[model samples]
Target chain A: MKLEEFKEREKRRKFLKEISVIAIGTAVGITTYLICLITHFDIFGWNFGLVLSPLFAGYAESFLAKKYLEESTGAVSAFILFIITVVWGFIISNPTLGFNIITAGSIIIIIQAAIPTATNYFLIGMTLAIISHISGIFKKITNFFYKRYLQLMGKLNLDPRIIREENAEEKYHFYETEPDMNHLGVLLLTLEYLPQGKELIDNKGIYEKREIFTFNQREELKSMRKNEMHLKLMASVKKTETKALYNLIKELKNDGCNAVLNLHMTFETLGQDKGENVRQIIVRGTGVVLADKTDS
Target chain B: MLLSSTSTLDNKKITKYHGLVNGEALLGTNVYKDLFSGIRDVVEGRTSTYAADVQNARDEAFKSMEAKAEALGANGIIGIKVSYNNLGGTMGNTILVTAYGTAVSYEK
Candidate 1:
């Protein structure tokens, strides 16, 4: 074959590979969904929808994994689908029955899956069932915790207010602020530390500074900073902070404070690695005072 | 004997200095160091994405200031200070860079 033809063939092969992966992903998703729908033994008043949610979840997860994750497995997809099936089963079933079955089933499945066996189908199914059941329980617990968290935030005196001023020409200036002292002052000021890595450098030729173990090496960095996931998280965090600060500033202005002094401090903590798990805490404080010269 | 130009324009003493040159002249060693350090922090792991963003903001502010200085026929700017509110919550990580400097005209 000519060089150009050979290159074209290689390109076609690569294209085919990608297409096949996508096809496999779709098949895994559809098969998992169908399996959950079929194998669903409605024990303890669990409806079809509730039992089938996990299958749908698993399929969706598999599809996403195929698209995002480098490695895609039919077995993993099936397992995830099965687990979702069980979780949904618990969700729809009677609370007592679901919890008991899930807890017991999950332990058994986890143990069985951990062990190597030639006939792994039964063990895999059991493991998936157990995981789903436990996940359902977790969902309930997390939901409860989330509700309580919101309630606690509300009780912490987070009074977000909007003040509009109409000028002589009927022009209005709107000022929005959050007056929750606890939320703004205490909650955000705290910082979490992330550990990057350590390095040893000889300071023979350098200045008086002998040696320093700085976390500045590019090779030591583990977290992917420029990824879409990190960007989304950053955007969310920025939006929250902006809203809070905007509200606080507005409130201060409404209270007849003309001048505001904002002090920002950032400090790194010891231990932990980069990413959400370990982050530098930035503390920003806004002091609102009367614009009178005497206050200065 | 030297023949001096006896024109009325001679009294005006026109000194031609490019705006770019004037801006450079106005830059303090410390301010330049700080700017470089800020840029380095953005490039390094010491700073977050927000810090890089702030650095970009500062650079843009300086560029605009330079343009304004040129329009005003000022030779340089001094005593620059940048300040902005650090909003909190998830979004508080965003840093707003605001730079202000005194613009002055220098005679060459």
Candidate 2:
């Protein structure tokens, strides 16, 4: 599709989404108002139920923005605040008071009557936005601690939904033949590590030939049993994999990727000349991100 | 075609090496299946349908990798690795399977 056409469609989609959010917010507001009326709840001569209208409206807007947009909470909240001000002003317009005041003063009096109502909504919106923003920060802190706890327990709880959406229309090149580009981006990683020393090394100079078993190598092997070395290698591999995955997440976050997909790890042993083998781990995956909501 | 998880075949010599090849398969579940699976877990202690679906996805991913290798004119694939991920959350409805390997031409 042409760029202009795509932009036009995106504009329309955003408009509709905003409208839906407003509708939901209004519903929550009206529900709260009705319950307040039924229960005869009041706070300092003002109906406490009325306060809930904008409070819940702001919460609903924040929740939707977090789940869908994920990155535009602040912008959406500001937009919703402006919209609610106008909407609440219109809803509370007193026709009798407007008619009475207009005859004595002017049409400006009618607008002046709506000012207090609009101001109340504006204050509520601002407070809600601030509260939501702080809550979002708390959620992030909690998630960080939770993930760290899981890692401490030797469980890597990586969520695939981190990349929630994938755009298949974009073209990606491959050396052989192009497969369906159902993912956002692709990466191939090869990690080489020394098992006994628990150290990582570069792949260079690996092809140099060495004797199968030197005396020093034999002594080292004798010091540590074959099974011990094997267990250590497995542990090292796990630790390396975890580190690589965390790095991938950080890189993808910078690249605006929501999640990783098609992730797999493969292992191979190079230079397996009796006890001096080099073990290599290969990690490959694609990134998936949120796509255009309208297109989906 | 000969496929092995090891880096080299038992006795065959590799004449040429092709780059990495990969395949991926995604399986989606419906609400009904999820509900029934929950009930089965409570009653039977197993959900056979999900297991079968996972196995099917793994097989499909392996097949896709093999096809990519064939397209590269490779007669053998080595160092094959397979991994599965649940897309969504703990009870996410989508499962993804990915398999990858190095393709090579080997002496018959």
In terms of TM-score, which candidate is strongest?
Answer: 2
Distance (Å) between predicted and true CA of A261, model 2? 21
For every candidate, what is the interface RMSD in angstroms? 22.5, 16.1
- lDDT per residue for candidate 2 within A1-296, as digits (tens), equals 69999999998987777667656656765675567657766534344444455455555665675565553333233234334433442345432222231121122122223453554565566467546564786567767985665464343222111110111111111122323222224222211111111122222211111111111235335423321222232233334443444455556656666533334564433333454444444444554453323422
Candidate 2 local distance difference test against the native: 0.47
What tens digits encode model 1's per-residue C-alpha lDDT throughout A166-209? 11012211213323332232111110110011111211111111
Find the number of clashing residue pairs for candidate 1. Answer: 14
Where does candidate 2 stray beyond 4 Å? Answer: A1-296, B40-46, B89-91
In angstroms, give how far residue A7 of model 2 lies from its true place. Answer: 99
lDDT of each: 0.36, 0.47
Prediction 1 global C-alpha lDDT: 0.36
What is candidate 2's CAPRI-style docking category based on DockQ? incorrect
